[model samples]
Target: MKNSKLLIIAAFFSIYFIWGSTYLFNKIAVTEIPPLFLGGIRFFTAGVLIMLIARFMKISLKLSKSQFINSVIAAFLFLVYGNGVFVWALKYVDSGFAALLASTQPLFVLFLLRLIDGQKMQRKSVIGVLLGVFGMYLLVSQKEISTSEGSVLGIFMILSCVLSWSYGSVFVSKADLPKNYLVSTGYQMLIAGFLLGVSSLIFKETWISPLSWSNKAQVSVTVLIIFGSIVAFTAFNYLLKVVSPEKVATSAYVNPVIALLLGWYLLDEQLTEQSVIASIILLTGVYFITSRKRIAKIKVTTKSQKI
Candidate 1:
């Protein structure tokens, strides 16, 4: 593909709009469908679709046993715990609020590096972490949200999901996997979907026919599977190859804003003054963290769907 201006714009649109829209979509779907089951169907269908596309494109699907194992591990951490649980939290948390919280992923990544890798925090990263912590406090301390039942638990779970995603980003950086990232993503999705599907059953979530789903749930799921899971990811990879890493990385800052606006407009989600202020402070912190030299690889390795 040529590095045409129009192509770049479209790719950015895919990553920014499609990914931001996913938060709203998941929120809509989870109102009716159980979260794990919703995750199962979305990822499984997306996995199959991506794998078929890979095959059609003549990309090799073969992986060594160890690679397959690593794929499963990545899937478990990233998709099952990170993304699936995050979706479950949407049952209680507003989509925009969750998106704002999830933006702290880069902070978690830096913290993990400091803990596990013994990497010294850069001055910028330190500042970013401080701001991120402060912003998070502001975000979660709202009286309206605190009064809502389950919102606190939902916020806690979403933060944990961010940690899971951060850990997975570190894992994928070192893990042996398929030569092609799309193939690796496909493998991860397939394994994660199956695991979450079984978990849904183990947890006794009711499964219903797709035809029985509410119109909104069905549309949301379709958008999630096709645009959120597949198309946005592909565009992310494409942009990384064609543009500067810094430019591609802007999605992290842009996504929460888009999510906030979309949620307010489409779902009638509240956008408190604290939330607006928190979003700015948090994204500023994220910018500081991601602006450093060490954070780029983690951004690249993190899932197409998550923080």
Candidate 2:
């Protein structure tokens, strides 16, 4: 029991801090490596590592044909376009700003649910949507920030990626995914890694050899693969089984904050007053949406258990 409690705490820390730190690490590695190529190598290596771990744990590596297809689709949506392109955009945008922008995933997910499932929004959720929109406006409309050379394009691309990810989240909920989340994630990463490699080749990206990379880039990519992909992701899956989804979801709130701080401190990215206020509003909106979802989920669980 004591060890389980310690493990839970450690898992939460991994998802919150390690996952959060990935934004900064990705920015560093992407500086020296082409984004698609970097993502390809990172995810492929991570996928292999995860599969080994799964096998050691006696987890099944098998999946149905439909599960394989769905995993591929999910991989394309979540990693290839969603993550690879977002990292590509980091060349033009500050890591902190990108993190803030990416934090709007829940808002996009809420809207996507409405459109796809014909789900009605609750009052708090509606308020959250409004706040999220306003916060996004404040985030992007900063004259000094948006007018920079390619920042506008980067922001737009990142937003599109977020939409793709949000849609993937919804799709995965209803899709025939592998029963084991770790197995599912490993398959998605492996499939996405291959597709990203193809994309890199199609784009004719200059793939930097490990020997050619700077020490910083090498360290950054290593951290991204080992800590970011494997450790944090495994921690996330573990949390979903042991904790409330809402509690696990709180990592969303902390991730951007950690990114913002790390970017500002380590990368010397700009941290304007307006950005601070925008983050507050955006996270608040996310809190509203997630908290409501938590309540609804709890009620349903309680009712089902009673029956």
> Please, what is the whole-model Cα lDDT of each candidate in the order they appear?
0.77, 0.77
Model 1 lDDT on a 0 to 1 scale: 0.77
Q: What is the TM-score of each candidate against the true structure?
A: 0.82, 0.83
Q: Give the per-residue lDDT digits (tens) of candidate 2, residues 137-255.
A: 67667764543479989989999998887676666655666888789879888988899999999999998789999999989999999998888876765665565433454565567
Locate the minimum summed-lDDT window of 10 residues in model 1: 298-307
Instruction: List ranges where model 1 is wrong by over 4 Å.
Output: 1-16, 141-147, 233-254, 270-277, 294-307
Instruction: Show pairs that collide, candidate 2.
Output: none
Cα TM-score of candidate 1: 0.82
Write candidate 1's Cα lDDT for 45-65 as tens digits.
999999999999999999999
Each candidate's root-mean-square deviation in Å? 4.8, 4.7
Which ranges in model 2 have alpha carbons more than 4 Å from their true place? 1-16, 133-148, 235-253, 269-277, 293-307
Backbone collisions counted per model: 0, 0
lDDT of 2 at 165: 73
